[model samples]
Target: MASNPYEVEHGIKPSAPRQTRRPDMSSFHSALHELLPEPSSSSSNRNVGPTPDALRSLFTLVLDQMTALRNQAPAGVDTELLQGLIEELVVDREHPDMKGFLTQDDLDALDRVPKKQLKQGELCPICTEAFLDDPYPLVVVLPCSDERIDPATGLTIHVKHEKHRFDLECVGPWLLSKGSCPMCRQDVNAEKKRKEIGNQERKKANAVDDEDEQDIVDGLYG
Candidate 1:
């Protein structure tokens, strides 16, 4: 039997195919309330909320525990969807103002590869479904890059790119919940924000340089 694509990539075997169910929002909110420390009744502390760092720590703990539980779950039971939902819930509770999903603009900015460009029998890492199976497939490539120092060579080594194509349908929801590539765990949203900041900084620097050059020319001409 052919190895399951997801299992091959992630090492966790699924006993059967299962539909991902929508998470119960009320239950998630209640659970978050329990996990987070309540506001103090004292006048001085009543308005204080959990610090961002504290919330981040709690989120990491919850995700780690949930991932372990999913790995240990009986085969054929699908807990991956639930795990993602819980993660989004935690993010929402911790930082309500923060956007957790890729905006439409972000999605539009992704490189769309033609379906024919995909190798035969290629499957989406998220759903493990063959991309060609769908009559109409919208495929997008993730911009993922990672590097590590080779212990033996003591030199920086760029990791070889793996299968990073996915049906938009399969990956969209996952990115919406996590703002990351499901296969690589690369934080796509965060990277985009960093790039935007870099661009802004460059523009500011160029403007200052242009102003300084103009001032120098005026002084020389006068």
Candidate 2:
């Protein structure tokens, strides 16, 4: 299997054991709300979103907290993953055009799979930790069908199985920065946008066909 580019770039070994001490979810959530306050209902601020500075501050705050948590953990707990993520975010901040981050809506739309459904040995491609390891694992299935069109033959090809699962925490930041499957390097957001456009075009064609049928009926009767 081809190596995930992100892993290769960051020197992340998929076989590394996950850190036993998980970051506090509530603390992170609290930090997020504090950094990016909810928009007011007033007409002046109704549709306004957080400024770039605000977002930068939030990222810094989260990274600092994560680093602190990592420091408190026992030795041999892999911290490379978190450091790799921070480096990637820094690069993304420097070069805005390089970012292919997924939107909140895109992340929200992913299918969540219960931890119990995953096999015992099944590991998240990003963190390489078994899904069952986390007591409250937030596992989500990637939308990649592992299907592609053969440019030479003009035929569709199935590269592999349709479902690719990952730990939400492990994959979320990756998708937010890179917008691709960590396992196959499939462009998730691009595929989603393509499907949406296809659906819209099909709906438009159907509408036109309906109108044409109505016109034909009127012509014959009148």
Candidate 3:
């Protein structure tokens, strides 16, 4: 009979503790007779806590957010909502009453967010680079007759590419492939109607020409 592998492994060593106990910190204390050391040069300057790299990173984050918001800002976002968001980002997040909390949060939030290409003619706040990327990721704005408007700036947002509207499933790709509007998603129908109307007009013109030719033929014969 062969020894069971599981039992042999377990028998070779005792199982590790599932829950280790924490150390007691009750006796921990600073030396009462010794004078406290002076704060380090780096730690002394509160305003100097942020390194050049950190500052640059922070600036980039602000710029990126601003650019994203601006690109998303279309023709119909509410002023109050924009104002509130701006205030929160600029006043509360950048310069908070609680200190490091806001700065840390801003960096974390911005870093986690995915980068979106701004719309045509839009500028990125971070790099100050004009948005020239094709297929811009534009969110729809509100308060317009159109459901697609910038939520932040209340401006009309145009999605970068006509094909993206179809890609987003807002409209069919075939319709957008021909550069049809994405809003109503009725581009195919419109194209079909246009073709039908054009064919009818052409048929009418041809019929008139045929009748004229028949008249001329009849007159010449008679």
TM per model?
0.43, 0.55, 0.19
Off by over 4 Å in 3: 1-49, 83-98, 102-222
Better of 2 and 3 by lDDT: 2
What ranges in model 2 sit over 4 Å off? 1-20, 37-49, 61-83, 93-105, 125-128, 144-147, 150-164, 173-188, 204-222
> Between 2 and 3, whose TM-score is larger?
2
The CA lDDT at 187 in model 2 is 83
Cα lDDT of model 3 by residue, 76-167, tens digit: 54334323334444543344332221112111221111225334555332222233432442222111122245555454333322222211
lDDT of each: 0.56, 0.60, 0.32
Q: Candidate 3: count the clashes.
A: 13
TM-score between candidate 3 and the true structure = 0.19
**Candidate 1: global Cα-lDDT?**
0.56
Q: Residue-wise lDDT of candidate 1 within 1-222, one digit each (tens)? A: 578898889988767644332222344345445544553435464235445665555455445444444565556665566467456646655664323445434666777878778777786654455677766667888766566665654544445244777766555544533567765678776655655775586568768775534233224421
Please tell me which predicted candidate would have the highest lDDT against the true structure. Answer: 2
Instruction: For model 2, give the 10-residue run with minimal summed lDDT.
Output: 213-222
Residue 202's lDDT within candidate 1 is 54
How far is 92's C-alpha from truth in model 1 (Å)?
8.3
Q: Model 2 misses residue 55 by how many Å?
A: 2.6
